[model samples]
Target chain A: MIHDFLIYFLLIVLIYTIIVMSFNLAVGFTGLVNLGHMVFFGIGAYASALLALSGAPWYLAVPSSALIAALSGAIIAALTVRLKGDYFQIVTLGLVFIAVTLSRNWISLTRGALGLPGVPPIFKDSLHYMIFVMAVFALSVIFFYWLTNSGTGKIFQAIRDDETASSVLGKNTYFYKILSITISTFFAGLAGSLFVHYIKFVDPTIFDLEFFVLILSMLIAGGLASIQGSIAGVFTLGIFVELIRFIDRVPLLSTVLAQHPELIGASRTMVYSVIVIYLLIFRPRGIFGRVEV
Target chain B: MPSILPQLIINGLIAGSIYALAAAGFALVYYVLKFQYFSHGAIMSIAAYSFFAFLNLMGMNYLFSGALTVIISILATLLTNFLIYNPLRKRRATSNIKLIVSVVLLIFATALLQAIFGSSTKSITLGQNKVFDFGTFTITSIQLSIIIIAIIIFLALWFILKKTRLGKAMRALADNKEVAQVVGISPEKIYTYTFIIAGMVAAVGGILLGLEQNLYPRMGIPIIVKGFVSSVVGGLGSVPGSIIGGLFIGLAENIGVLYFPTGYKDIISFVIMLLFLLLRPQGILGVKARDS
Candidate 1:
């Protein structure tokens, strides 16, 4: 039983690590506050789920969903890159709502809030699936580490620090920004694909604000602009998010929680919010983060 | 379709008034602080719940609960400025950083509210609210009050901004902070006043919105989005523009339901905001260009 739980936990942590690292490319390195990252995740989940349900192979569904997300990411980036920073943030944030509304209202395609379940798995058993996900996670870490350390990563940071200065240096800042977002979203979509196959379900609730906040807290706490930070953030917040469940084991809190079950979710959000607020105020760079908020 | 058009317009006007009230406060803070005050909706949520507790739990009369809630809202806003925003400003944080902090605060507020009140929806009144019928359309008493009170508030705000000393100082600061400082206007003082005024107006908005609809922890998100849309549509930092933008969105969304599902009503406002941002970031009354 303990081994099974551990496997599930590790799988979740690995999945989150990929998503947060990709998210960091756009937000931490490129300095784009793209709150619409979840939209890509949702799109990937829905696409993969639909394809898998239609009897497509896991390999085919995963890549196809990721490609679809990447295409949308590039389009979104191209449309909004010209916006000033704050406007860009708000517009991207607005896209989350638009995407959620679309997913909910377009019932014929997505199944709406009813969700699409019973997605086919890549591996037969949890153990094999964990090993497969671990391989994917390792590859993602190596790829992200290489990208962030490369010359292109340097340009992303340069654009983030000052777009005009980078543009004056003759680099196409717009193209670079779009490139960063597209790549970031590709990975986000990939994570979503993996997540759906593992959970074997996809729903509009995947785009909940609570989940977004959870991912954001991970990014902030782990620190931005560092692969190490993203890993550290994923584990730290992921563990805490799961760890809070054990609060039910504590004698006093268990009774209170039993009486009011909803408090558990509420408390988790409160704790993360407090941690994030404190970090942003006093330690804007975050625990593992090099970039200041 | 034509028969329902008048009703939709009336409904739009009612919603517009509330959005205008909320947008005015949001725009006021944004104009002065030069950041998206994302917590404005959180403050609205807080005030709405406070009004709810006062009216329902404590069994206070309407006027008394409203008055008390306004004072509480003002204190809450002032405290947020003193505790959170003021410190960030002192550290010379960038607007993006502040915006991030505000978003976190918003999430915190929602979580805290949920923890205290639970996730269930609550309404101000228990039974069916009173309504009056016109020939073409029917109007609820609460909706009528919302419009009347909004017009009154707008007139009051116009008078204050145009005629009062405080309003002039606020305008001066928003126009050029350094120039206002050079002339002897204190920004700290104006910021405090801005928060207080914003808090008071937001309290009124919260009460009316709660009375018109149901109150839930997440209600703040959608309302704030609408208010943000209104502010963007009218002009980011312009007060009168927010009011106009609010009404326009309200009308558009309601009328848009004619062709789309009712669930898509919110998308109408969001689309308008995007169109405005892309095509004309300056908005109707805004003089500043988008590049800024």
Candidate 2:
């Protein structure tokens, strides 16, 4: 029983690890707040699900999800690149609101809030799915490591550190920003596809601010701009979330919380918010992040 | 078409008033502080539930419930600033950090509200059968009061800004903080007053919202977004701009469904906001683009 739970837990941790890593490339490396990260994730899930249901092979759907999200990232970047930081965040948020509204309202395509269930998994078994995710994680980690060491990565950091200086140095900062967003969004889409296929479901609820908050918390906790930190954040927060799911089962704690039984779902989130506050106050750079500013 | 049109217009006007109210507060805070208080929505939720508690739990009359609830909201806003924002400001936290903290506070606060209130929708009973019908448009007295009170508040706000010392201090702070401080205008005191005003305004919006639709702990999220959209469209931090933006959105959404499904409302709003942002980001009032 415990072994099964651990495997399930590991799968979740791996899924979030991919998301946080992908998100870090934009937020930590490129300095775009990208508040609407979930829009890309949702698009990828729907794209992968619909394509697979229409007889596309797993390989085709997987890469196509990345393509679609990349295209979306490019378009959003084109429209919003002129704006500075917080405005960009709000624009992305608006996009998320629109995307979620569509997902819920375009009932024929998305099945609305009822969600699309019974979608087939890529590997058929949970253990096999975990292995598949592990392989993907390894390849992504390797790609990030290479990218970070390469000159392109340094340019990314330069732009993040100071866009004006980067522009003065003759770099097309907008192009680089778009490139960073494209790459990050591509992986985010991949993560979404992986998540949907593994869970065999897709829904409007997948696009809420909580998911963004969770991913942000993970990146901040694990330390931004580092693959290891991404992994650590995923493992720590993933386990924390999973553990909190069972907090209601703890006899002593449940009794103390019995008066507010409805709060069980809220307690873990409350705790997470506190932790995020502490982290931002003490280590805004994150647990593993090296950036001072 | 005519039947739906009047209803839409009426709906738009009422909703616009509420959005304008929300924007008034949002603009005041964002103008001075320059960070998205993502928790603004959660604060609305707190005010909403506080109103609910007073009206339903304590069985207070409408007037007393409304007044006490606004007071609770003001105190809550002050506490948040004192404990969270003030400390962060003291350290000169980056805009991004302050924004993140607000988001964290939003998450924690919304969850806390849920834990306390339970996640069901609550309503304020106004003893119905009093809705007045006008062939094409119908409105309840409470909603009428909402519009009336909203206009009154807007007028009061304009008066305060144009005439009061605190208001002058705030405009100065919003205009240029360092210079304002140098000229014997204490930014902290002005900001505190601005927050109080913002809180009171948000409470009115929340109370009206509770009366109009049902009240849910998370209802503030959408309300805040619309409020924010209005503020941004009007150009962030501009008082008149926020009101215009709010009314524009209210009208836009209602009028939009004539050509599209109601679900497209969010899309229409965002597209309008995007157009404003990409084109006249300084706002319709054409305030010098604060940040290029």
Best-matching candidate per DockQ: 2
Question: Which 10-residue span in candidate 2 chain B carries the lowest summed lDDT?
Answer: B283-292
- Weakest 10 consecutive residues of candidate 1 chain A by summed lDDT: A271-280
Per-candidate fnat, comma-separated: 0.52, 0.62
Query: Residue B288 CA error for candidate 1 (Å)?
Result: 2.0
**Candidate lDDT values, in order:** 0.87, 0.83
Q: How high is the lDDT of residue B221 in model 2?
A: 80
Score every model by TM-score: 0.95, 0.96
Error of 1 at B163 (Å): 2.6
Model 2: residue A285 alpha-carbon error in angstroms: 1.5
Interface RMSD of 2: 2.3
Q: Report per-candidate DockQ.
A: 0.56, 0.61
**For model 2, how does the per-residue alpha-carbon lDDT over A197-242 read when each residue is reduced to its tens digit?**
8888899989987788888888888886787888888888787777
**lDDT for model 2, on a 0 to 1 scale?**
0.83
Give the Å shift of residue B194 in candidate 2. Answer: 1.8
TM-score of decoy 2: 0.96
Highest lDDT: which candidate?
Answer: 1
- lDDT, candidate 1, B152-218, per-residue tens: 9888888878899999999999888999999999999999999998888888888888988898988
